[model samples]
Target: MSMTNRLKVDRRDGKLVMAHFYVAFISLAIGGLAGLLQVLVRSGMFVLPAGIGYYQLLTLHGVVLALVLTTYFIMGFQIAAVSRTSGTLTSKQRKIGWTGFVIMTIGTILAAVMILLNEATVLYTFYAPLQAHSIFYIGLTLVIVGSWLGSAVILLKYRQWRKENHKQTSPLITFMAVVNSIMWIVATIGVAATVLLQLLPWSLGLVETINVGVSRTLFWYFGHPLVYFWLLPAYMAWYVIIPKIIGAKIFSDSLARFSFILFLLFSIPVGFHHQLMEPGIDASWKFIQVVLTFLVIIPSLMTAFSLFATFESYGRSKGAKGLFGWFKKLPWKDARFVVPFIGMVAFIPGGAGGIINASNQMNQVVHNTIWVTGHFHLTVATAVLLTFFGISYWLIPHLTGRTLTKAMNNLAITQGILWAVGMTFMSGAMHAAGLLGAPRRSSFSEYGGASIAAEWIPYQVAQAVGGSILFLSIILMLYIIINLAFFAPKGEQDFPIGEIAETAEKTPKILENWKIWIGITVLLILFAYTIPFIDMFHHAPPGSKGYKLW
Candidate 1:
């Protein structure tokens, strides 16, 4: 069956997908505005309104963009991918998805209202000792639960398909979607435990104190994998969609599946790398996690190799000559291709920064600094955000039955470039300032005219400029998306699925052995975390009472 036919049959599912995107874009707009405010305030160029504190805005920005926008957008994209690849969802699955969306939406509203009211100034991490209203924690918990429910719908559908087609392999996109959903379901367990068992009770006065170390451990357990949760969707685009856009085939489907499996296995067990700078965790345990962190990089390297091979093969087939001719031969004109391609390139530095952060010694140098901020910006901001932007160029139109006009396409290209340029200035400055001992999560001017502080001023100014540009770019993106959703001419859109170059190289059935993979994943997590957590609880210090700093 054709992708068009699949999409036509699932047109009803489009409403659910559209709801998710709408929430995502709305979060992006507000979060982006808050980002601009952060830079301005941090640079000493602008003061916020009287009732709106800087911390409040920071919390709002982080939660909305990192938690809300990414979660909603990823869920929406995966739903569309599954429906388009596998088949239309059953009514039950649709209901489950809508239930999750509604719950998540309510959670977002509760969290946003608390942030706006200056009641929940705890940053996205919501780390212990810095408490917020119980509603804030409850709201975040709902968001996680809602996403799990949505993922359950995808998982159920995938299982149903497998049962019906006993011998057939799932479509690459559908398989990837299901794998990601499972990973999410597994990853959120740590956070859910922390929120439901620890923070929620403490916040609600049911408990007077909470174990800070355990709370942080639980959060990082979920935190590092959360990055991969954001990343895999982008990887899906790179491995599956970009190849089609570039008139190439996936270099190796089996290798791609292996990469996802590797990610699923390795992504969770390495979260201790984030806590290397903190005490209570054993150094030996941290070292082990650092090694595991390097291990996880294998899948990404495999992906990079696969992408390059695809590009080279396609370029050579198109009559390109010379060592790097293939690089030049890529479809640079298509906004859909260029945006994600640039995003992948940005990951080179982003991934490198990640390695630095994962290292115990190196992390001591950059931890809690603006360097960490720069690292994630390169990752989630450029790599993930840009790829999503690329997807949105076609996705919105595909769901809405609208034509993505040439002007809008051109504008998207412009938006991508602007984002790149702006990030270059902002993240570059952040990296430089962090190296010079600049702190992160600070609202005040650091230097106060001291010579050491004076050194960071230029970088601060550059960040402000970069942030302003980014704000404008997002506005342009929202304009394009709104037009695509509402005012564009109606038409059928193409859903491109890449072919595999090697027809003879079938993906191994073992690659799809969920039981084996999940078992291994559980064992690895137990190996990595069991000792540290046991030690934490056994010799745990008296819990700390919550503090409301603001």
Candidate 2:
């Protein structure tokens, strides 16, 4: 094959793969720096000035990673998987794929521009009554447009292959891509509705006002599932890649399928759980959202059990004796193993925090406090970040034909552990401080109470330190990825062992059995949601003067 032909090998092994790894590092660096700035300013650090810098950085840290990195990286992986699993992509589809990348990149730049200017400093939720510049909304829309286009290409190519080869089932990874894309399509609906009907009008001054409560409700519709949108990729890593990395076949493919199903069904209905503290919403609705929060636990536990069992199988196969002995037998040296291992550690504490926040009663204590921030940092910064880093390590070598040094991989593992541990201590301290009534979103001292002031000092300082360590760790990660991507020696490398041999049998008839699952999820969400809204109608909103918007 000519070099150009090889470049278009329709396989996951080429420049496109390397590009994905490099992109992950860049996004992580941007996001991590944003994260550090958030902590430093929130810590009341003397060096950090008060005002726009703090909020701008916080919003950038979030919007950049959550909006740009998550979608872009997921699409890259999805594209690669579709091509490999389908055996090839048509020439037109590859062009669409790159086009999506360009659009997303431009959208991300627009967002960052707005954020740095402090014009889009609404902290990503962009909750109602807090509007950013018009460009922010436009930037966000462009991002959605790009992602949707990518999804179309992936599904279309998959369809083309299935039509050509009538004797095939979509492989597990390909199925995951289709399912997640549908999830995104469903997830984006609320944001799309709100932006078009509410935010866009408000931004353009076409409307003097909009309903705060209603707008908030709409945002959460996308807001919470957005986490799953951020998360499903990490979970995907856990389900498909981790077991293979650890030297075991998937414990149960059916169980893995079910976890994705749970993600689809339960992820959306629970958005109101984020609103537990807000008034004007009925307690009954909050209660239901809380229940769905627990519903999320079922799938999470299934994942934990399945992943652990896979490791157990691998351990036994490698001649290790006894239960839990697999930890020692595992290939700690492999980049794939490192990513999922840290992910597992972060998942335990992060998942627990999620459950706590999901509870209506507990949420009242932690809501709008530093504790809430801590909980998410544990999950997003810790768990999701690890998955991103791990995949880079695994893919970069094959994509770039460069051997990522073992020393650097080990450095990554150590850094990951410190990052997790640091986040835990800081977040735990925040939770304790929150119960002590340290209010969130304040930029002042304890308003003349020394005792309260004294209590906050320690936790704030700890967060700063934790944030600092995490920040440095992110820099190290960037160095590692950059070295591998551009500077490392280039030579052919094989894909990780134990990848499911691509074959006709793995593909499924329906890449996205859209009607059945999507329909069920919509209905379940409606059933779970309507009662809350109905009850709220009879009750009154707190602090609302007949639905004031201005």
Best by lDDT: 1
Q: What TM-score goes with each of the models?
A: 0.97, 0.89
List, residue by residue over 270-325, the lDDT tens digit for candidate 2.
88888887777777777877887788889889988988877777788788887677
**Model 1, runs deviating above 4 Å:** 1-9, 446-451, 542-550
Name the 10 consecutive residues with the lowest summed lDDT in model 1.
541-550
- lDDT accuracy of residue 275 in candidate 2: 84
Poorest 10 consecutive residues by lDDT, candidate 2: 1-10
lDDT of each: 0.89, 0.71
Name the runs in model 2 displaced over 4 angstroms: 1-24, 49-52, 165-167, 444-451, 497-512, 529-546
How many steric clashes between backbone atoms does each model show? Answer: 0, 4
Task: Report the lDDT tens digits of candidate 1 across residue range 23-89.
Answer: 9999999999999999998788888987788888989999999999999999999998888887888
